[model samples]
Target chain A: MRSVSQKATPDASRRSETARRAILTAALDLVGRVGYAKLTIEGIATAAGVGKQTIYRWWPSKGSILFDAFLSLTTDQQDGALPDTGDLAADLKLVLRATVDELQDPGFDLPMRALHTEIVHDPVLAADYATRLDEPMRELKRDRLRAAQRAGQMSEDVDLDVAVDLLFGPILNRWVQRTGPLTHEYVDLVVDTALRGLKP
Target chain B: MRSVSQKATPDASRRSETARRAILTAALDLVGRVGYAKLTIEGIATAAGVGKQTIYRWWPSKGSILFDAFLSLTTDQQDGALPDTGDLAADLKLVLRATVDELQDPGFDLPMRALHTEIVHDPVLAADYATRLDEPMRELKRDRLRAAQRAGQMSEDVDLDVAVDLLFGPILNRWVQRTGPLTHEYVDLVVDTALRGLKP
Candidate 1:
C-alpha cells in the first residue's frame, strides 16, 4: 500500500507493510470461515482491526482482496519457476506432487476453493486471475517444457499451451469437480502419461 | 407426482408428465435469466404456472431441480453412448466438438456455469452431481476408450480413467478457469497429444 511519494518514510512504509499483511491474512481467514458469498468488507475490516477505508484504498472488492491473499500464499511457496533437473518426468512430478499436497491441506483448500468459486462466475475476476495467477504459473510451467524441447526430450512442433493443459488439467479438473482423489500417485501417473505424448 | 397406488391412473400420469416438463423448463429459464444465486422455488413456480408444492414434491431442492433440468437437456442430445466409429480419433473429435458447441451456446452456458458455481461450494450438491451427472458421462466416455483398447487402438496397460481425464480434463479446466479459449482446434490437439501416449 506504499505510494511513490517522498513522504513515505521507512517507518511509514513498515506500518503500511504490516497493515497490508494483516488485511490479506484477514481476508483469507474470513473467507474460509464465512465463505465467499457471505464475506463482506465490514467483516474483513473488523477481523483485520483496520478501518474499511484502508481496505478500500488498496482493494476495490472482496474478490480482489481474496485474489491478493491467494496470490501471496502461492508466491511464498514458488519462486516462479518449475524445477529443471534435466529430467522432465521427475521434475514435473516433483512440482505437481507439491501442488497436490498444498491442495489437500485444509487451510489452503477452503480459501482456494473460495477464490475459484468467485472466479468462475465473474468475468472481470476471471480475467484478473488469468493475468495475475494462471498465466504466470503457466509461463513457469511452459519454461520447463521449453527446456525439455531444447534438450530434445520433446518435439519442436508441440504446442506448449496445449501441453501445459494436458499435464495440469486433469489434476485441476479432478480437484474442482471432486471427481477423484488428489494423491501423489495420481499426479505421478499424469506426468508419466503426458510425457509420452510430449516427448520427441 | 404420481404415487404407485390404485389411485394412479393414465389421466393422472399424463398430467404429471406435463407438469414435470413445465417445471424443468422453467428452472432452466429462470436460472438463465436471474442466475442460480437469485433463483428461487417461488420464482420457478410463478414462471412455470405450477404450485410451489408441485416442484417441492417432485424435487427436494433448487439444486436437484436444476440437476434434473440439465440432465433432461443432455438426455435429449446424447443417448448415454459416445459414438463408436472404430476410428478413436474421429469418434472423440466428433463428441468433443459437439460439447464445444454446447458450452458456447448461451442457453447451455448460463445454466451449466450456474450448476458448477453451486457445486463448488456445496458438498451435498456436488455429491449429487457426481452421482447423477458426472459419473454417467464419464462412463460413456470410458466405454468409448474401452472399445479402443479392445481394438488394439490403445494400449492394454492404459488406465481408462486416467485416459478419460487426459482427454477431457484440459478442455474442462480451460472452460472452468477461463484460462484459454475452447475451440475445435484446441480439442483436436488435446485428442492428438493424449492419443500418442494412449496408443499401443
Candidate 2:
C-alpha cells in the first residue's frame, strides 16, 4: 500500500497536469476561432478556468502559450522520432504518412495555420518556432540520413540539408498552399522519387 | 514623325499608366510598413496622391488592391515565362535562379510576405490568389514538363502535378520559412536532384 504522503504528492501532480492540458487546449481553441492577433492570456485563462498567474508562471506571452500548446499537441509524434528500420524509403514513407494525417486533422490544421501566419509576419515568433519546433524535426531527419549514409544505403555525397528539403518540401508546400489532397499515395510517391534521387 | 491623334492618345495613356504604377507602389509600400491587417484603401490613395474612388474603382477590397500590386510587381517575370531552350535542366535552373533573385529583393519580399500571411488566414483570399497567381505558374510548369516528356528527357510516367510540386517546393519552402540562403548553387542542386529522379 502507498503511503499517504506519496499518494497526496502524485494526486497534486496529476491535478496540475490536468490544469496544464486545459490551458493548452483553451489556447488552441481560442486561437483557431479568434486568431493569434486577438488572443490574450486573460482570455485563455478564463477559457481554461485557471488564474491568469498560473499561465504567466508557465509562459511569457500569448505567442509562447500558443507555441507551447502546439508543442504539447505534437509531442507524441515528435517523441516517437522517425523509425529506423534500416530501410530509408520505408522509414520516410511511414513518417510522412503520419505527417499527412496530422496535417489533415482539423484540430491541428486551423491552429497551426494561425501560428504559421504569425510566425511568417513576426521575426521573434519565427525564431522561437524555428528553435523549438522546426529544429528538432530537422535534426531527426538529418540523423536518419546520416545513419543511412553510414550504412551505405544512401550516397555519402548527398547534401543532407538539401536532401531533407527535397524529401519534405512538397508536403509542406501542399499543406501551406492548399494545393491538393495530402493523401497517402502522394507521400509514397514523394518518398519514392526522393529516395531514387538520393540513392548511392 | 507621329500623327497628332496618336501623339495625344499615347501621352494620355502614359499618364494613366504612371498613375497606375504609383497606386501599386503605394499599396506595396503601405502593406510592407503597416501590414495587410492595418492597411486601408484610403491610406493607399493618400500615399499615391489619388482619390479613394480611384482605388475602389480598380480594386474591390484592400486585399484585392494588395494582390494587384503584387501581380504588377511580378508581371515582368510572368510575361517572360520559363525559358524553353529545349533543355529542361538548364531552363528550370534559369527560371529558379531568377526566382531566387526576385524573392531576395526587399522590394518584393516584405509586401509579398505580408500578403501571404493574409492569404493563409483568409480562405477567400487563398482561392483568389490561387486563381490569379498560383494556377498560371503551375500551368507554365506543367507545359514545360510535358515538353520534356515528349522530348524523352523525362519519364512519361511522371505525375506532372507532383513533379511541379517537387521541382518548386524547396524554393518555396526556403522563401516562406527563411530557413537558409537561397543561392544559385542551391537551385542547381534542386534542379539536378529533381531531374535525375524524373528522367526516363
Candidate 3:
C-alpha cells in the first residue's frame, strides 16, 4: 500500500489538492446552511461535484471531513501562532483581538457553532476534536507563554498549560455562550487581566 | 387568566409543585437518554405520568422546560454565589472547585450539555439563556469581586465584568471543550493566577 504522496506525480498531487479544497468548501457551506444535524456526506459530494466514492476515499466519516474543513478555514489565519513582539501584553492583545474578529465573522460563525454543537452532543467526536484541533491550538499558545517565561516577562513558576487556558478560555467562553459582543475592548481586558497575573 | 399562585389552595399548590418536579425530572432523564434533538414534550409528559397539556400549561416550549430543569438541578448547590470567606483566594478556589464537581457529575452533565447545544444552534434561545442564566451567574461572581475590591484584596480599577469572565471562563471553556481534566489542582491554579492579576 503506497502512500498518496509517494504514488502521485506532481500533476496528480495538484489535482488532488484542488479536489480536497473543493470538498472542504462544500462541507463548510452545507454545515453552515443546514447545520450539523442536517448535513450529509452525499450532500457535500453533490455540492462539490465530486463522486461519493471520492469523498469516502479521502475521509472516513462526515465528522472528519467537517473537522478538516474547519481546520482549513482557520489555518490561513493566525491559527494560534502568537506574535513575538517581546512585549507580552501587546502580543497577547494583538492575538486576542484578532480572535475576537474571527469569532464574530459571519463566514466563520455558523459553521463553527454547528461543529461545536455536534462535539458537545457526541463524546467520540468531542475527544477526536480535542486531539485534532483543540490540543494543537493550545500547544501553540503554550509555546508563546514559555517564550515569555524565558524572557523573564512571565514568572518561571506559572504553569504554561493553565496559563494558556487563562489566556484563551474567556474569549472561547464568550464565543460559545454568545453572552455578549466579541469586541476588541473585551479581548484587551482579558489579556490585561490574565497577563497581570502571569507577570513576574 | 388567573395565575397558578392565585388559583391554588394549599393542597392544590402542594400537588402542583409535586407535578412540576416530576415533569422536570422526566425532561432531564429523557434528554439524557435520547439527546436534545430527539427529546419532546410528549415523551416527557408520558414519562412523568402527566398529560401533554400539563406541560404546555407551564412551559412555552421544550427548550424553556429544559432550561428550567437545569436551573432546578443547579439551584440547590452554589447557584453562582461565591463563598465569602473574606479571603478572596480561598473563596474563589472553593467556588471553582464546586463548579468542577458540578461539571463532572454524570447526573447533571448530559442534560446540561443538551441544553447548551440547543443554545448554540438557536439565536433566540441563546439570548434568553444568556439573559436568564449566564448574566445572573456572572453578576453573582461580579458582586463577589466588588466585595473583594472594597476590602482592598483586589484592585479598585479592575473591571468587575471582565474580571468575572477571566475568573470563570477557563473552567467553562474546559467544561465545554473537554480539553483536559477539570481537577482541583486546575481550579486552584486558575484562582491563584487570576487573583494574582487582580491584586493591587
Question: Per-prediction DockQ, in order?
Answer: 0.72, 0.62, 0.76
Clashes of each: 0, 0, 0
Task: Return the clash pairs for model 2, or none.
Answer: none
Assign candidate 3 its CAPRI class: medium
Candidate closest to the true structure, highest DockQ: 3
lDDT of 2 by residue, A1-200 (tens): 47887879989899889999999999999988888888999999999999999998888899888878888877755674678989889999988998899988878888988887887778777788878877877888999999999999888888888899998999998888776788999999988887777887
Compute the interface RMSD for each candidate structure.
0.8, 1.3, 0.8
DockQ of 3: 0.76
Q: Given candidate 3, what's the lDDT at residue B121?
A: 74
Residues B1-200, model 3: lDDT tens digits: 46765776787878889999999999998998888889988999999999999899999898888888877876768655777989999888888888889888877888889877887778888898898788877788888989998899999999988888888999998898888899999999998988899999
Residues A58-95, model 3: lDDT tens digits: 99999999989888877878754778989888888888
For every candidate structure, what is the RMSD over all alpha carbons to the true structure, in angstroms? 3.7, 3.2, 3.7
Considering summed lDDT, which 10 consecutive residues are worst modelled in model 1 chain A? A1-10
Off by over 4 Å in 2: A1-7, B1-8
lDDT of 2: 0.85
How far residue B144's Cα lies from its native spot in candidate 2, in Å, is 2.7
